[model samples]
Target: MNKFLFKVSFIILFLFLGTAKTFAQKLKFLIPDAGIVQHAGSIGYFSVGAGYEIFKNKKGYLDFNYGYVPAFKGGELHAVTVKLAYKPFEIKLSDWAKLYPFNPGFFLSYTFQEDLAYKFHSSEYPRGYYYWSPALRPHLSFSNEIELSIPESWDGLGINKIGLYTEFNTNDFYIVNYLQNTSSLSLSDIFQLGIGVRLKF
Candidate 1:
């Protein structure tokens, strides 16, 4: 299982690097933006990465992040995640404040840890006993963000905008469990909340 995971991770890293190289070649003049996240679903305790804004108006984005989980929590976990998000419309509250009512997205993450198995079966168990993999986690979420613009004159830095966002998410395993026991499980039991920030360049 560990060998399989290593192969998978290597392939994914290769693909990601290839894609990033192509994107950079296509947009030679534009610089990629970066952000930091904390406690996001399937992204470990904290993450930092770079991303590119897509589309003519820059309403969509693709991000790649590397996250870490400490040994004290539940052994050490190192994760790589790729996320895509879209903001359809933005509401201007004022000159300095803007609200993005909805930013729906999905993320795929893989954790490097031997203790967590991709399959849950031993020689004693029959075939197809447990189907879900704990090492590879996929999540879907909806979020809202409030952006506050920073004036260039206040600080000569290149950062022009900062955003605070909150997301409500659910994983594949949680959804499957919820479907099997709808009578016992509540919505809150299957859902998780994550909050983070974005800095625009």
Candidate 2:
């Protein structure tokens, strides 16, 4: 009876170990692949975010960001953004460096402000009272970034690469204004510039 019990316990222990390993693998898949921080670019004065390369070959990324604008700078704006980007081309500079010449993306931002009111229901206003919501902005962007691959010696730091990027962005409201007042509003007036860093793990 003792020998039979020992065999059964060993089998159960082996099954538990297998299940735990599978769970760990799934959890690892959910971990973010990169982190980003940026300044300016229409979302806010500054933002911090995390992202994952959702596609193979690093072709696409989905990021979530929180942004802030100080009262002195804007009006103490707070926003959350979800951005999806596509990068289709890469130039390999060396074994340790690569350049992505074009990355085009779109983002949706939701703003939070105490003094401003956003009407969600049509009953709050007559037809076409306001064409757009002040609290929600949809933006289009184009950006380029360079990646510097880290050596394996730095693996302990958990960072595999570092990237520097610059972005130009414009929102739907800006585009509409530009279209309506093309003679007065220059293309430059509708666009904003942003710079940031990305760390890949």
Candidate 3:
């Protein structure tokens, strides 16, 4: 509770102090999070991102975000990794339901810096180089998420939304084969269970 309040306060303070004279729209802040499915164990991560939804005249909306997710340099090896997503789902969930593909969402993101391999057993693997070359770097990701929201959960604005992201598809990863303690592949792709909140206008 304390942490949530502090973040909310910071968001409000920055929203006004940073860009008060920019536009005429309700300021929306989001705290998005999800659990990582791992072979060893699962860990939770949270990201704080705030952006404006540019409402068009009788049309769609445009949104932007800037945030970061932190973790151990080897956290990616222990079944945990963070992704920055720029999600642009339909503003009206109910309206989209009437269309094909049922409930859906898609996002584009770039990682500031991601852990590619783990330095297991302290000295079991060399620690001189911790990250793979950007060419072989598997830190960046572009994953599209789609979820089925239970009826009556959304008032059409996507606010106070609750649903299950029963489908997840992220098939991109960068692990170096020649790198020590790092394999040719890491457990990042495939579908998993997900739950998130959408505070939209």
Please name the candidate that would achieve the greatest lDDT relative to the true structure: 2
**What is the overall TM-score of model 2 with all chains considered together?**
0.85
lDDT of 3 at 1: 100
TM-scores vs. true structure, each candidate: 0.78, 0.85, 0.30
* Whole-model Cα lDDT of every candidate shown, in order: 0.83, 0.90, 0.35
lDDT of 3 by residue, 1-201 (tens): 999999999999889876764543343223322222211111223333332333343122222333333356333222223333343333334643311223333334333334432232346557555443221222322233233443464566544322222224332332233233344444452333333333432
Q: Candidate 1's residue-wise lDDT over 48-103, tens digit each?
A: 77777887988888888888888887778899988888999799999999999999
Give the higher-TM-score candidate: 2 or 3.
2
After superposing candidate 2 on the true structure, give the runs of residues whose Cα lies further than 4 Å from its correct spot. Answer: 1-24, 117-125
Clashing pairs in model 3? 138-174
lDDT for 16 (candidate 1): 100
What lDDT is reached at residue 179 by model 2? 100
